[model samples]
Target: MKRVSCIDIGTNTALLLIADLDTQEGSIKPVFHKQTIIRLGKNVDEQKIIDHEAMQRLISCMTDYKHISKEHDVQQIIAAGTSALRDAKNRMEIIDEVVRACGIVIKTISGEEEAALTFSGAVAGMEELPETFSVIDIGGGSTEITMGNAQTITGSVSMNIGSVRLTERFFSSQPPSEEEFNAAKEEINRHLTEHLPPFFEAREHVYGVAGTLTTIAAVVSGLEQFDPEKIHNFRLTCEQVGNLLDMFRRQTLNEIMDSGIPEGRADVITMGALILHQFMKLLGTESIRVSIQGLRYGMAWKELQKLVSDGETTNSA
Candidate 1:
């Protein structure tokens, strides 16, 4: 089968998906997907540029991805850059370097576009999208919230309150102190309150996507091997969120790292979870339905939909 790939380069991670696309009854499905943590935005918010080490790590990842695609005979690819790219001063230079080194073109999409694409991806497998479903895609550098119905969009907002960004901005501790955690949560809640009210009003279900949410789902389900099918659409209650947050608070970063989390994730998972917990509390939501689908899946599905609508075969460009 021919393959289509989507690469999402965010502040904290770089994700790659190579899928065999299928179109039947006006629906598209991805057959394969993979993700990695590159932490491109590691210290960008503080340093103001994609740091040298982070840039090199990213280049290596992209080079490997390009080679893998070639080995698989894959041709069609969509590469997108999010928050860090949007804010970096030397973004053009960074983009040029990636293209020269990896043979891949990267497009930096707007916040609204990110939210919409994520919403499309998250809702792709659902039988019916709610009239007022709030889809949240929380990244390392930013968070996107989209409120919409089955056929039309209502409002979309992207905020600069992600795991990496938040960790650097506040709670600079091995394990965040209660005072620090409370202060951090207050800041998040304050920032969110300004923009979230319009989006949260009359919302029915909250579908959370991206690394933070999925990681929480994985830990919650106690899955030895990550299973999206088993956890996607699974709800996490506020009480459950509080319990997990408390559990992580008791364990140090090294302990969590030693326990089982991927090394790259040990640093920021707690920060991400705390932010998520506050968001859920602010929205007065008891639970959130997980969506393994996100921006990369959304972008690929959009292109596939255009192809199918134009009555073209699932052929690669």
Candidate 2:
């Protein structure tokens, strides 16, 4: 078993997962996990920049994560950066500063890689997953849809539409005006119709990960705060998703937050929920099983595999 931490740095949040990866069991046992919203991709969609304040928030967050990892006595730290990092014009500079200050190296992954990693991680958490299944990971800046099984992936794609991106681009108010709502919907539709192909559509047994899905699950379960044990593996149906859309459709951000959703999520969740609603509608999906495990767990599994390989090489030498 190897004790390692995988940091999933996204457009809106930075999630940390520390786990004991057992090669023999092909399993990851969680030791610690944390999620922080820093909005790393705050204005990347509009300006293609990470900005100074965002960078400062990132460095400070990473520093805390570093101290936490040390407290847990983790052997390794793997920092994975997604959409925000992928589109940032000054990513390298931010990355260099992160290394200098926090001793963390941020590896920005492509959309395809993010999809595959998310798929692998989501399925790993489930007690029983189908031979053929797909996963949709909706983040702050991008959404990844991946179709695969236990062995290999058949199809995967990532789109540029996301909660924060849409919120910043179109949402002028909490619930947004009718025109703004229609405009956002149009943009979302264009991405889905143009980029997502026939193969990825009409998938059943879809697994969903990331903030958007989990927050919805929490709402469905009627919990004021997050409860991963209850939330994980929860089945969310099409009607439920639609109902959430209707519920949040008229509520302002403050109202949404008062309804129990966290501040980090309340503002953007309407857009996020809409993305899920539209995805399910277009794809003809009946339901999705929520998985709290995502990119970080996938990274943990990969790290374990590499560790096993390195050990074998050392023995041979």
Full-model lDDT for every candidate: 0.81, 0.89
RMSD (CA, angstroms), candidate 2: 2.5
Clashes of each: 1, 0
lDDT of 1 at 38: 84
Q: Which ten residues in a row have the lowest lDDT in candidate 1?
A: 23-32
TM of each candidate vs. truth: 0.94, 0.95
Clashing pairs in 1: 11-41
lDDT of 1 at 85: 89
> By summed lDDT, which 10 consecutive residues of candidate 2 come out lowest?
308-317
RMSD of 1: 2.0
Show where candidate 1 strays beyond 4 Å.
Answer: 314-317
Tens-digit per-residue lDDT, 87-119, candidate 1? 888888888999999878899999999999998
Candidate 2, which segments miss by more than 4 Å at Cα?
200-202, 311-317
